[model samples]
Target: MTMRQHAVSDDFLRPDSINAFTDALRGAKYNVDAVLERLGEAGQEGLTRNQTMPALDRLGDATDAQADLIRLFPLQQIVPRSRLAAFLDVPALIEAGVLGAIGREGIHADIDVRPYGFTDAAGEWSGWVAADPIPGMDSIVTRTRPNYVLGVSPASTSLAQLTVPDRVGSALDLGAGCGVQSLHLARHADTVTLTDINPRALDMARLTLALNGLDLDVRAGSFYEPVAHDSFDLIVTNPPYVMSPPTDAADRLVYREGGFAGDGLVRHVVREGASHLA
Candidate 1:
């Protein structure tokens, strides 16, 4: 797709754009049933674990002629938000049995859900809190702070942007939250290993890669645990650096806490990374 075809202005999230996107999805067969299933699943769970590309790919596989039709739809083009939310909302509506499909007139239902901005790291994105029970995972709603450390922060993006691009080499991204750095590095790196201490973050990173059509190895473990020594030409980490109070152990989310006092996490990573670098 051309830049203009995919590019949406800052105001792209307006009601009109959403209506257009809904109409486009409703017109496609794969979008109708599959998107509904996804949204329904999301309502039961806070998020969807399955990636979006496979469903789109399955649409193509189901019918040869529809493959090109799916390509032309460009759901991402109408609104540059995370595909996970889009996929989840559709299924949520379908599962509720409130709408047969996302017709233009039915767009109001989405607005009612109050899809507001959740994080603004690499791109503008929004998330909706499901009122219904989240499937499989615990139903506990995670309370988030300003989270100077959660999601994709500026430090992570800066490392990614500053890294040399358009080169082929194996790269390792330690603590790859949301996979922003890994995704940018993928522009030049042949392969990327995204390691994270939190499985939820790895899950989000996988969704990010899927949305962008980029592939990376998503492993759940502490820094460098999933990777071999002397295997990476480039290793990058934007670790948890915030200092928390001694009594407020609950304040430290897995993505934000280093399990050490002061800059101990950073120091440890630097020392350990030296041994792993190729």
Candidate 2:
């Protein structure tokens, strides 16, 4: 297994380029419902298993805008520059750090771009999330990265659904990896603060927010230190709960395994949550 760190430039956050990228995504029907509908049960299951062949088979050889986007994003399959250029601003994608170009025709994504959405009492939340592709995904080819930021996970969806969507004055996403929780919170909170220990996660979260046309206060600190001096009307977190036993740094993953042991991290959050909650 080969391990690699995720890298992308801040230029990806340029408003005009991001707008064009998102517009193309919407025009291609790259949303939760459409992508899943196209993938079917087998393909969906394959994705869950970190297997791409089934989904690739389902997608077939179609180079249509949506299929190409699907292939490029979630599937982690590289697309030929010419194919993507059919619908996307290819040069802008390269310049925006969405894809790499060595003056070559192959376009590859170092990170993952996923379409996420949920409807709440406030309104509809539909947008893309940009995060480091979780390590060990496509398990055969990838290994863990020390500070990998997770995109949307099963827990992410459940948490989003579980959180009460009532409007609030301010909210904090305590461990906002890729800002998934913030996407939901931003709609209801007049202000949202995202804090994470890993700087990479903070970057990914910021990228996620920028892509979604939402901006929030992002700070770097483990747990609550960044917001220790402040409180909010609502505080939300989907923390690392893998409960892994002690291991070397090689075995630790920031998104799942915190420096704390077992559920200590979770316990600390629960124990200290009230003090920060308004």
Candidate 3:
């Protein structure tokens, strides 16, 4: 059987290419501390609420590589080709499917990439995450795109922090959007498998893990279907738990809605997710 390729094909999936992409990002100083320092106090605070304008304003006219990447990504601003090339090799990133040229406006991020950092008993870990943009507060009502894969958020951090720091032989991150939980699980588990119903989520998860020089088994399936009749030493997931009345909303966001009735998805995970856990 042939497997479906996710996002930009598998041409750029090689370790050498992934490592090059990682090097470029590292050279530009894309990290949590750098981003916070660039955004200043107000902008940093604004980001917690999904606001980026303040950070954008602070980054005004800054052609520095880090600034250029920030504008192109988390801020979702298009930047000039020359400026973007100053910090990043536009051609290489384009080949890696990380950057795309948008007409004469120069370059923009093909994916949402941002620095994520956290502390555990093992000390602190920091890395970049990639995913589709979250519906910003001002734009939520106008969002019309369904299947929007989510980037890093408070919930991801909370779950990572709350998790027990136990070593395990294998781990499964269900609904592994952008693979943040799976990334954490890699540090403790001998093997990690990331599964998601959304194909784009799986694609982004694969890229997210690769960008960090980590490898895991990525599968496309709803919940435990991908691992049928199998179990793991650990299972971690923050399934869609939103509680709201159904509406004919144009944007049928998969990241926020689990297709089941309100909160029912959460219940289903609670009831059935254990079957996949060792």
Candidate 4:
């Protein structure tokens, strides 16, 4: 499988460019409710299974800025430049590293952008999560993307929702991917720190928070290495938890594979977590 090269965090953080890009999304109502309403029930259901054609078919011949983005983002289709420019800053998108020029054909997304929203007792939180597309996504032809940093997923969102929303002085989101958990933590914690083994994931996390007009501390390293000297009032993690059949270390994936034997990663985190919590 030929893996597609993705635009990193630095590529998308231009001040003016990002400002324009987000403004356009807001003007177009490109949030979860709007996109879901546009896709309809059937299309939304198909999307969960990684099917894009249903959504694409439902959005046939639409000519609005939100429609353009819905096609370009979730459907992963190359869109007419003119139509996209109506609702998005095409040049800004290119500068921000989300849109790639396809010569004279059109523009394509270099990363996945999807609407994400959740409601807690405090009310509702919503925003888009941008990251490397999963390899087997219907719109993505590749079979595997080893360095892929995931966007909001079922497992990740489940963990976020299950987390206790107790107010705290500080919180740590270990193995933070695309900053989803950190975003949730920001609503309750006075300060939030996100750490990840993959630097690219850290980059995406920063962009995700920045796009949503939130700020936090981001560090790079495995587990507690970056925050060894520090402590937090709360700690949350949705760690890599896949178990491989063979004992071979090479069989593990960085995102899912914990370097240790069965459940070792979680155990290690648990053992070390006490020292870092107040």
Candidate 5:
């Protein structure tokens, strides 16, 4: 089978693979800079600070240039394309050499085929594509739909940062999402249970925890159903608190809607959580 076929068979879009891709793109950014500098030496007006700075930003991930490079290059040429781009930005990163071969049978094949595109408010060219996945993250929610609980939101990070560490017996992470809070709690707790109604989110939580080298108990069930009653020393939940009507009830997925109106889920979790706590 062809490399593309092999990649498709394997799901290579894991977090690590994304990181590698991003690193290569960063290398490309340096190459681009050198070219711009040479252009300045030749009195070709060089890249304007404004034009050039954005290209540097584009090297990170999911930008127009990265996407275009992915689409333009042959399958076998991806790593080299990435390296060439990297060499353009930072010559030092390319000293070890560009990738000569990509393992066809990898888990993140779809990421290679998927195109990353972006548009600004005035619809100007945002010439950048993500060459790597965000560390510890898989997919980002780009669309705002009703019943869609925002994942990795600032609020979740805030709560995670504010969490008080304790040498607890057990902890429960309700609506774990990406498992950020659960992973945080794992530092101090003996065991952490990450629960989420969305299986996809749960999968990501598992990956995130494992990536961090923490062995966590990942369960998929509606809030509180997966755990034994009164089993946890502490329970932390960032429930679906959006007050808007769901775009589709089936799409509620428990991440956005609490199934109760107006902080009902939060209140229920608070009330029920008291019972679940040891």
Candidate 6:
């Protein structure tokens, strides 16, 4: 098969495959702390700044399975098949579109699967979040596509920290990007509904849930549309609040640009979202 010529599809989401992937990741110790441990203090600092070279340097000589995973994922570097297959389901991940084959002996991740862990009233939680290949991590794209689903950002981290920890019957993540906020809600809410307008974002959200060995409702449509008749005890939104100049071009990212002028999108989300809460 032409492994390098890949087209990401829903075929890679097989439940059994995803379960195996999750197992491999945990077995490889791929988590928030793994990155810090692999890339010492200085390397961690550089990675935090989006400067991957330092961390990449730290992993240059490391040949363990975990190190190979760190390179294939976090550093976006290609890894030898034999090494990664030691801990990961290479064929399953490749079929799922999570990992793509490069040359005969090398493989690389097609998306950014980040280790996301946070502390809340529910307790300590750790999960994997998937999104489009980061531009900086991959040499393929100079800019992001319109539907580019961003991974974790300062906004998501901050919003996660500020969320109410009380348990609820049902929860809604209004503008679920890669479902980061939804992961948090799932901890406290009996059921969590993730809704997004972008198609790719919806796919990433599902992948994020699957990687964490969790599942919840993930729908597509503008805010409140997917859950029109549904009501939730708690509702949270980590929306696109960039408030950039109005533009309908392909350069406008769906994850951050609300496509409305000024604060109009924010107002719309807040005003319309209030009605969906129980």
Q: Which candidate is the best by lDDT?
A: 2
Candidate 3 collision pairs: none
Clashes of each: 10, 0, 0, 1, 31, 1
Between prediction 5 and prediction 6, which has the larger lDDT? 6
Q: What is the lDDT of candidate 4?
A: 0.81
lDDT of 2 at 243: 78
> Roughly what TM-score does model 3 have, to 2 decimal places?
0.89
Model 4 stretches astray by more than 4 angstroms = 1-6, 9-15, 139-141, 245-252
The sequence of per-residue lDDT tens digits that candidate 3 reaches over residues 153-238 is 78998998777769999898989988999878988899998999888888888888877888789999998999998889888888
TM-score of 2: 0.90
TM-score of 5: 0.53
Error of 2 at 169 (Å): 0.7
Expressed as tens digits, the lDDT of each residue in 22-42 for candidate 1 is 444334433423434533443
Q: After superposition, how far is residue 155 of candidate 4 from its true place, in Å?
A: 1.3
* Model 4 worst lDDT window (10 residues): 1-10
**Per-prediction TM-score to the true structure, in the order listed:** 0.50, 0.90, 0.89, 0.91, 0.53, 0.91
Candidate 2 or 5, higher lDDT?
2
Look at candidate 6 and give me any clashing residue pairs: 12-96
Question: TM-score of the candidate numbered 1?
Answer: 0.50
lDDT of 2 by residue, 1-278 (tens): 22223344566677887788888889999998999999989999998888888999999978888898888878877789988888899876665556776457788776688888888887677788988764555776666687888888889989988888888999999989889999888888899999998888887887888888886899999898898889899889999887774468567888878767778888899889889987
